[model samples]
Target: MPGSGRLVDVVDTTTRDGNQSLWGATGLTANEILAIAPTMEQVGFHALDFTSSTHMSVSVRFHREDPWELIRLMRAAMPRTLLNFITTGMRFIAWQPCDEEVMRLAFRCVVRNGIRRFQFAEPANDPSALRRVARMAREEGVEEIVVGLTYSISPVHTHAYYAERVAALADCPDIDRFYLKDPGGLLTTDAVRELGPHFAATGRTVELHSHCTIGLAPLAYMEGLKVGFDVLHTAVGPAGNGTSQPTAESTLRNLAAEGYEHDLDPEALGRVSTYFRELVREKRLPPGEPREYDAAYYHHQLPGGMVTTTQRMLEEIRRPELFDAVLAEVVRVRAEMGYPILVTPVSQLVAYQATRNVIDSERWLNVSDETVRYFLGHYGDFAAPPDPDVADRVLSLPKVGKLREAEPIGLEGVRARFGRRISDEELLLRLTMPEEQVDAMRAEPAIAERSVPVDAGDRAPLVRLLREIERRRQISYLRVQKGDDLVVWRRAS
Candidate 1:
């Protein structure tokens, strides 16, 4: 095989990150994911990120599937590869913090369920909080710890700020790698040109984890590779491109051109893509595709996952036309209320506040409880403080006083509320949510029916092409170009 001497490991995030983009976070059922696990394993990816505490809650809340079972199934199918989880350090996936004992028990449950890798991220860039949990992840037998330096654009999030944080992680013995995570897909090539080399200079293995929201992730990946990133996180074709990472096929070609070697079997990866293409067509699910760059995204900075969700919320109120207005409001809301890094809970909170500002006749008249809690410093620290006038208004709200008086529940409180004899998994779930919701999850069915039947026309060509390719073991590479579209596949010799 012709290759670049330097090896680059490909970590696929289709099942995990792709779900966040395409399915509003809980779209794929446990059975659907399990069916594709073996093929993903065959693709020879360095690692596969399967779930997070957020996705686990999504599983039980929306899919009625046991998250523990999902982890076990994925681990069983991909025994040779590391199974990964995403976490917000000690918070354990809830919007608020949890007791240390609760976090410790959750780590044990994940490790016992066969998750070998943990991707710890703290949006606030607080290393002390992460250290408390990273040690626990290691103590519980996790083999790999990838800390995410979440990417965002703000006054406090300059290139120097990120470089300092990455360097700080070097002292943590449990951190094996650092991930430059662009959850909003906001990283541009110019920024990557400067930031990439500085990250390489950290003298630690760095992985570029970005999204395709504004379509610059591919360009960013190329720049990162040229500057010496050790790994690139991407997703398979039918599950990639638009809101997810760039397609593996295109990335492989670009990396090969740059003299990098990847162990991924492209032909096997194509088969995996083929399965999803057919599955989406049959289920009438949306197929992920590359999107043109949108400059407006720079101001809104809503991730691909949040874009779809905010769109749905707009439609629900019959004010879909106001979607752009909400995006515009998000820019203002983020500025007035401290410039927090836009990821997960923060991103969701910003959007919620913006939605109220756009819909209500009076500005700030209908703030969400979460937004009030944010002003109360419940969601960790922010890079900047809220505007003076905005701070006074938020502080004066009656809800702020009520929230301050409310005591947070610790491990003993959780046991008192849910009982001590309950298994750790059940206790952890209840601790993050109400007991009624967990009970409903236990009573509901495992899976839901597909939204629509598969179309024969949509599935035939790809299905036939894959079967033919499977019959030709002697072929090492396949390239097909039609119009401006190009596809490439490589098989193990």
Candidate 2:
């Protein structure tokens, strides 16, 4: 097992994928990432799945941190390894069809800032749309384009179905490799053994990206490796098990026992894991514990990040008990809606409609605007045509007809929507999010990079906590009060 020369590449998705699972969707601020990035750079992984347009929006909208700043910092920290970003076809971060200019500029911005590779996928599996985006991205200096075969179980998504699509993807000129993305961790070991080889047969480098949601990802990964995948996605300690990808430490151990060699340094990766494990403990964040195999996950096919978000949405409506029912409805609705692979946009659309159906007792009564657009073919053609009755019901809504008549925004339209005063990159950000939010982001100064203390809770020093306030002195008086404590301070002009 010392050096069999069957080398594998380990792509880490901790900052992006793990943050989505453990921390909320936009968790893991830039400061937190910078603290551990240098260590991860030394771990010898192939690349880091770092950030995305969704991540950028989340950073500015919720965390008030600059997303570009994150890229710049991470690029400087990990100058040796490649950075991977996720994108949907012709869209930056939103669900609707985005302007062509916005998409082009965003692609260039991502690459210019340091993302050397991109993982592109859309739920509808529109090869032409993917090729279009890839062509533009290639022109804009993106080094590697990784198109994904998003995995799910459905009559329309059989092995034959994927083999044909994989063949088509192989012909895609801009695609450097392919990824079999099982975001839901829904693939069985046997299924992977059958499906994995198809991707490799494409004559392009292929990788397996899956979640540990159903506890079958590791097994599925082994099967994929047996079939000759060139790379596997994994994460470090707190970011790895549970609903996230399998831990790199465990995967390396598995490979060593199987008589294979990988480029990664187990000792360096272990230190990275140690850092995150401590971070999880100090922050009271959930650890990526191995989950028991749950048969229900096959039906829901909800990714790790979505599981928490869906739960929160249910809790907000005071219908937490209906969570299981909602999941079931998702399966039924997905089948009715043509079995689109349950990844983002489609996954979110189906989940929303399912929750509505479960709560309202009247299916499709209050359909979301996005669902109507999906039914009308604004996103793209589905794998299978939608159930006729469901389609009729969706279109019967007052706004669906008008939405269908709308056209995709072009470069000129984008320029008209936002003035030419700002740089193309800034305009792209403004177009991706609400103008008011972008304004707020621009108004806020960049946060100085610093180490994030996980357990600052009540033990944090008052002076250190209120350092921002201390900088403002206009003959000010300050007082703080907690449950059973009070402190006061005054200063003369």
Candidate 3:
């Protein structure tokens, strides 16, 4: 990730945040993690974000066996890869870190385990929480601390506010590096541009943890580079798709095109992309695309190019037509507020770059001169510079204001809508919600029923696919109502 004498360290999170949404459907094994380790190294990523020991029971067990042992093994396996970890935190990492002593235990996991670096996704709105976490990291002698912006949760907040919160942490004697964590999968390059100066002001170096939820990670990262981020978080292609982050391939390619000397090998990136794609494809998974290529991919494959979350929504919701309505409502709200309601920055870029391809897109694009300049900084010379077109077309894109503001749903409703078999992660992602939302999603029958069904062409494909999924045993059949139609024995598996 070293580019132009500026050592831009890259963190490859393909198996971690990059696969958060996919974890429900597919949990990579130790071998799977190991297999991709080389791919990461091949791609010239400075390091692999490794795994979150705090995520699940299996991962915890893996951590307990001596992280050093595992790191040593991975190190031996992919000697070139930098293995890192995010020990424990507020979210899925529900480790028994009941007290401050637990913090020491987490720290030991890093140093004793050959884990050179570590991070915790510090939500921007929660400065107190971030400071506490940062203080602990510093106390533990942790080499580097990446402060995650966790951008998606508080989209309503401004760039200045986030910078202020992160900047405050910069002075914390215990920390080394800072970062922006765009966990909600909603980050944009332009947003990064607006953010870089604030982080740079901190005097401490800053890093960025972006996502490809709406696919602008590469661009966001590039913007961060223009503003000068010391490190950039990324992943291999395709696996770095929706719910993932900007891919190493695209980021490197962008840097390369700009005539930067990336210390990591570009050929290695290509190899890793191929390696990752084959595995994902074999896993019966979808391919991840770089935001840089999303416009091309979106133009070439709109129906398939849609994010997994949106596709899941299509499958779980009742009113097939409601998607359009939901998007329209989103557009109406965004237009009313004066911007395109893009899920992320790249989604806006793709919309601006490929108008006819995005779904009912034209109405939501509210691109402005400022946005086009940002695009130019990231995408380089456009045969047709998107700046003016972006400004002209920004309002033309569609929005999802209604869906974004949707209230918590219920469980019996969950049983009816997505079926009782829906994994907690899938349910949360599809609903654009949290685990607690599941409790609500199960309570109301109508709310659940209001969702789209996980439809297959017929019972045969459905049954076979269900059986293939390990969760088939967890599902329960139920009834659902859609307009004048009601169906019984409706299965979620």
**Best lDDT among the predictions, by candidate number:** 2
| Predicted candidate 3 versus true structure: per-residue lDDT over 1-493, tens digit per residue | 3345465767777776566444432345444555545545566666678755433333323222222344655666566665667743433233111245434554554555566677765322356666777677667666667666545312245676676677667676766667766654455667777888888877777788766655666667777877867787776766675657666777766777765656777776676666566556556776664433333322112222234434455556443444444444433333232232232333334333332223345543444332443332321222222335334444233432232233223233554665668644344233323344434433434312232322212224433354345345555664546799875553553
Report the number of the highest-TM-score candidate. Answer: 2
Find the 10 residues in a row with the least total lDDT in model 1. Answer: 448-457
How many clashes in each structure? 2, 0, 44
Which regions of candidate 1 are displaced past 4 Å? 1-3, 444-493
Better of 2 and 3 by lDDT: 2
- Per-residue CA lDDT of model 2 for 330-392, tens digit only, reads 889998999888887778888889899999968888898888888888888888988999998
State residue 204's C-alpha deviation in candidate 3, in Å: 2.5
TM-score ranking, best first: 2, 1, 3
In the range 237-300, model 1's lDDT, one tens digit per residue, is 6778888888888999888887778898887787788777766665567868888889898887
Model 3 stretches astray by more than 4 angstroms: 1-7, 22-27, 36-39, 54-72, 78-80, 87-92, 95-97, 152-156, 290-493
Sort order, lDDT high to low:
2, 1, 3
Candidate 2 vs. true structure, TM-score: 0.89
